[model samples]
Target chain A: MKLSLGPLLYFWERDVVQSFYQSISKSPVDIVYLGEAVCSKRRNLKLDDWLIIADMLDAAGKEVVLTSLALFEAESELGLLKRICGNGRYPVEANDMAAVSLLEDQSPFIVGPHINTYNPSTLALLSESGARRWVMPVELGGETLKQLQQARPDNIETEVFVYGRLPLAFSARCYTARAQNLPKDHCQFCCASYPDGLLLKTRDARSFLTLNGIQTQSASIYNLIYQVPELVSLGVDVLRISPQSEGTLETIDAFYHAMHSEVNGNRKPIEDWQIVDYEFCNGYWYGQEGMLWKRTDEYKNLESALNR
Target chain B: MAITPVGMKRITPELVCPAGSLPALKSAVENGADCVYIGFRDGTNARNFPGLNFSTDEARQAVDYAHDANAKLFLALNTYPKPDQWQAGVRAIDLAAQLKVDALIVADPGLMRYASQNYPELRLHLSVQGSATNHLALDYYKRHFNIQRAVLPRVLSLSQVRRVALEAPVEIEVFGFGSLCIMVEGRCALSSYVTGKSPNASGVCSPAEAVRWEKQGDHLCSRLNGVLIDEFSEHEQAGYPTLCKGRYRVNDSVYYALEEPTSLNVLEILPELMQIGVSAIKVEGRQRSPAYVAGVTRTLRSAIDACINNPEEYQVQPSWMRDLDKVAEGQCHTLGAYHRPWQ
Candidate 1:
């Protein structure tokens, strides 16, 4: 399986974003997704800036894709979407149907995870519209991915989100602004201070969610390094790693090594893996509550014991 | 039901209402609903609550009753079905086709294709679950399946709604009143994150099975799957536990970080909606009772009529607002995204 870097979902300083991509050009990720996929108000990087980074990554032998905004509520956003679709050098990852419609009949595009692709017919229809690859929705489980794999059209690749905080929802109201008692219009770009998003805890002090500008994400890091073998068995073409403020390169390296180990058929023990030190959850892969963590080995051992 | 003449020729906005049961359907039709939308008794629709929705026999009765009163009955096959339950959605579409329901409100593109191909004559209205906030997205469906109408998601402001209505290929529908969804429908997964059930897949949010209530001293606490949603004081009202509307700790403060539990009411902006060429106004409460549906539908029906009769001299009656406030969630209402500052 190939490793791909998802679009940066957080807002950062222009220099920080540029330097991050500069380092990413030398990384092991085979594909790089660039552009703002979260809020349109985040203007630290424009289309021109993304294209310059795309050119650098292209020179570094990396395939680059421009991702559109997940939600568009203004004409300016749609105008930006049109420019991204006509970027002329890279394929656009259509996060919403507006991007899909704009990219249709023009070139092969990617259907981003935000677009609903639960069933086979939706996959087929997107394929018919010249979709080259489709990312699985973050909340869908491995079982659904397996079924979709069986029914996917020819030449359409399947990509699954394998790492980073899962983006759970988007809203018109900005929770980052609301947290500071500010309205969305006059948010003053306060979310810029939170490079990894502000953590929101339940009243009981349990970390429940992370409040990005207009997006809510899982507080737990969704790591599936142990499930790489299962993902390979399911015929997943690419594994997507969402970029974070810190230690994303290390996470990418861990996934790269994990993918190589699975390819060599010499699955190493969990202790030998250079995994990041973070609370991990794979419950969505196991079809349980997304916040719950279930070990694959536990289920395997239970099955073996039952058989014996 | 009368179309007042705007600048040129413009169709009067229809008052589309919701019905969880046959009585609600009848009440909606009798109270001046131009159309009534419902779902099956199973998970084919968004409001998959216990003892709610309609069986086929009841659905047949609903169709007859709505048609007799010159109101259309629509079936909502809105949820995205996974492979395990894909056949259930197809079966629901087949049933809608067989019943000759006036329209089938759909969200899934795959299911939209199925309904469009198998039953070419069946009218299609894109459900709010589809989350088409712009005209380009609406055009995609209109170009592919020839959808007659598309319900705009609640994410768009009034000006954005007008921009879409000006360029959209199909008729437009906007939610006028109901419990508000802070996030875009069909795109949210916060419910599944906590309860393992989602409106997209299971057609329910905060499913009843995952909900637990406990009283601690004088405070009443409501929990969903062992997660404390809120703690209500002795005199405070404890609203239904939805993840978005619940109080949570953001930074150092604990409050309704996403939104407070309040219903969305657009009675104050009926003229603006009609002026934007919106074809329909929807009152959203399929899980509510018949009396709730009747009261909301009656007020909205009169409001729409009054707005049409004299677009230049129309005012939202104080009594209309009072009637709606009686059934509003938390006994409070906001204009939601329609008012730009609410964002």
Candidate 2:
């Protein structure tokens, strides 16, 4: 299975973003999705700047796809969307219906995970509209993906978000701004301070969510490294690894090695990829609570016996 | 307030209300709702509560009762059903068609396609859960599924709503009053992240089964799937443990880091909504009581009528606001995303 780097969902300094992609250009990921999928006000990277990075990634033997904003409340955002769709070079991953409406009947495009492609009929409808690949919606389980894979169109590719903090929700209200007692219009670019997003914990001190500007993400990173073999067996074409502030390259390396080892018939120890300190969850893949960490069948018996 | 003396004006917007049960449906229609929308008794719609929503028999009676009152009955098949439940959604669409409901409010593109292709005559209204925040998105739904109307999620400002209303190919509906969804509908998975059930797939948010309430001495604690949502002191009235509305510690401070528990009340903006060409005003509560439905419907109905009678001289009455506040989620209201500052 091919590895794709999902779009960066946080706001970062322009230099930080540029250097991050510069390093990503040499990463093991075969496809890269870049652009602001979160807030339009995050203008640290201009359209031209992103185009330059897109060109750089393309030159480095990696296919690049541009992502549109997931939530657009203004007509000004549509102007930017039109430019991205009409870039005439790279494939645009349509995040919202507006982008899909603009990109349809033009060229092959990708339906982003935010577009809510659930069943076969929606997939078929999008496939007819020139969608070449569609990312599975984030919260859906592997069973849903398997069922969709069975009914997937002949020309469509399926991508699953295998690693990252799951983006749980988007709002007009910017939680990052709200956290600082600032209105969204004058948020003061405070989101750049925490490149990984501000952590939100419940009253009882359990880390529950991450406030990334207008997007709310799961505090626990959703890691499906153990499910790579199952995803491959299910015929998923791409595994998307979202970019975090740190250890993204390491995460990519882990997935690359895991996929290769599974092919060699010698599964790697899961402990090898436990480099990140954040809690891991794969419950969404198992059709359970997304925050709950369910061990793989290989270790389930051992863990359950220990619990007993 | 005195009734306006001006002649009845053009395009008095439709007042669409929610009906979770038969009594609520009757209450909505009797209270002067132009259209009453209800979900099926399964995971076919967003409000898939335990006893809420209509069974097939209840739906049939609902259709008759609504039509008898000259109010439209819309069946909400808005949830994005997975492949396993796809057949169930298809059956619900067929059921809506068989009952001769006025329209089918749908969210899933696949289900919309099925409704459009199979039941060509059924009028389709895109649910807010469809998450069409812009006119172009609404146009896509209009072109592909031939949707007659699209409900705008409560994420757009007043100007954005005007732009959409001005340019949208289909009729536009905006929520006027009820519980506020801080996040865009259909796109949100926060509830599912914690509870494994989301509005898109499971047709509920922070489902009640996962909710736990405990009295810890002087404070009442509310938890969703064992995740602490909020804790209320003895003097404070506790709200439902909706994930987004709960207080959380952000940046070393405890507050409503996302949004406070509040209802979105657009009563003050009735004239502006009417002027902006919003075809309908929707009240957002299906899990509420029949009395709440009746009170809210009556309040909004009068508010809309008052605005229509004299768009220039109309004002939001104190009594209407009071009546709506009683049934509101937090007993307080804000213009939500419609007002610029609220965003």
Candidate 3:
């Protein structure tokens, strides 16, 4: 299985983004998804800047794919999509149907997680339309992925979002701006302050969600590091690690080691890779609440015990 | 209000309303609905609430009753199905076709392909869960599955709705009145992030099983799976525990950072919608009571007729607005994304 770095879903300084990719170029990640997948107003890294980084990553023997925005409401956003699709060099991850419509039959592209490819028929149709690989919708459990893998066409690759905060929803209104009592049109780039995202807490003071402009994300980081062997056995082709503002390289290293150990048949448990101020959740993979972490082995043991 | 010329021709858009049960279907059709949309008592549709949808037998009866009243019956199989549950969705589609409903409102591409392949003559309307906001996305579904109509998500402004309606290859439908969803449909997973179920995956949002209501001091707090969604003071009324409409702490202050628990009312823009060639108007409350369905259907029917018959004098009646507000989410209504100021 190959490790792919998912696109940056947060706003960061241009220099910080450039340096982050510079370090990733030398990392163990085989494929890197670049470009903005959130608000279009996040212009710290323009298309040209992303292309420069893509070239640098390509020179470092890394495959690069560009990602489009998840929610678009303007003609200018569509114009940007056209330019991204017409880049003529790298594969584009179609996050919305508009991106898929633009990239269909033009070149081989990736179906991003937000495109709603949940079953075999959708997979077949997309594969016919020149999709090389399709990311699993984030909300689907592992049982669903297993069934899809069994029925997926041989030509299409399957990628799963295995790390980082799960992007839960997108809206026309910007919550980060709303948090500061600002409208979306004049957001003042407030999202740049919280490089990860503005954490949303419940009235009981429990961390619940992350507000990143128009995108709402999970407060708990989705950690499928322990399920690498299970994913490989299920024929998952790529495991995607979404980039964060900090400690992304360490997260990539942990996943790389886990996958390598599984392949070598000398598996070692991942240790000392926990980032401060982040909670881990693997429940969505187990068909449980997404914010709850359920150990697969423990769950199986409990199930058998209950049967007895 | 401007009055229409006496000799002018007016094209009235179809008034589509939701029906959660046989009685609701009959009430909606009897009241004034030109079409009634429903889902089976299963997870195949987005309104998979318990005790809220029709059984297969009930659906068959609904078809006959709606057809008898010259009302079209649309079966909604709009949720995205996983491979394990794919056959159940297919069975629902077959049942819908066997019942000879007017159309199938669907979201999943896989189900759309299956329906078009097996039931070629059955008309297909893209569900709002399909989230086709632009013409190109509509064209994608039209080219692939030959969809006859597409419902626009509530995220678009009135101008954007007009642009798509003018350019889309298929007929267009817009939300007329109902509970407002702040997030884009189908794409939102906020419910599943806290709970295990989602509208796209499980055909429900903020599942009732996970919801808990408790009184803390003088406030009533609503929690979903132990996560506090909102708290209301004694003077304030409590709404459903949808994650988007919840109050949360974003920075230093606590408020309804995403949206207030209000409903969407578009009666004031009926003229703009009609002028833009919108083919139908949808009322979104299959989980609502039969009385709610009847009242809303009747009010929208009268408003639509008044607009069509006397376009120049198409004033929004205060009574109509008040009737809609009484059944609205927060006892209040906004234009939602249709008005530019809200966005």
List chain A TM-scores, every candidate, in order: 0.94, 0.95, 0.95
lDDT of 1 by residue, A1-308 (tens): 78999999998999999999999988999999999999999897788988998999999999999999999899999999999999888999999999999999899999999999999999999999999999999899988888999999988999999999999999999999989888999999999999999999889898889999999999998878778888989899999999999888888877888788777887544443334346677888888889887757743453455563
The C-alpha stretches of model 2 lying farther than 4 A from their native spots are A270-276, A297-308, B1-10
Residue B225's lDDT within candidate 2 is 96
Best by the DockQ measure: 2
Rank order (by lDDT, best first): 2, 1, 3
Q: What TM-score number comes out for model 3?
A: 0.95
Using DockQ as the measure, what is the rank order of every candidate, best first? 2, 1, 3
Candidate 3 segments exceeding 4 Å error:
A274-277, A295-308, B1-11
* Poorest lDDT segment (10 consecutive residues) of candidate 3 chain B: B1-10
lDDT of 2 at A110: 97
lDDT per residue (tens digit) for residues A69-165 in model 3? 9887777888999999999999999999998898898999999999998889899999999999999988888999999899899999999999999
For model 3, report DockQ: 0.69
What is the RMSD, in Å, between candidate 3 and the native fold over all Cα? 4.5
The estimated TM-scores of all candidates read 0.96, 0.96, 0.95
Q: What order do candidates take by TM-score, descending?
A: 2, 1, 3
Q: CA shift at B64, candidate 2, in angstroms?
A: 1.2
Residue range A1-308, candidate 2, lDDT tens digits: 89999999999889999999999999899999999999999999998999999999999999999999999888899999999999999999999999999988998999999999999999999999999999999999999998999999999999999999999889999888888888989999999988999999999999889989999899899999878889989999999999998899989988998898899998766554545457878899989889999867755653454453
> Please, what are the lDDT tens digits per residue for candidate 3 over residues B1-343?
1112111123468999999999999999999999999999999999999898988889999999999999999999999998878889999999999999999999999999999999999999999999888878887988888998998889888887877776688888899999999889989988888889999989999999999999999999999999899999999889989888999887777898789989999999999888887888999999999999999999999999999888889999999999999999989999988887676
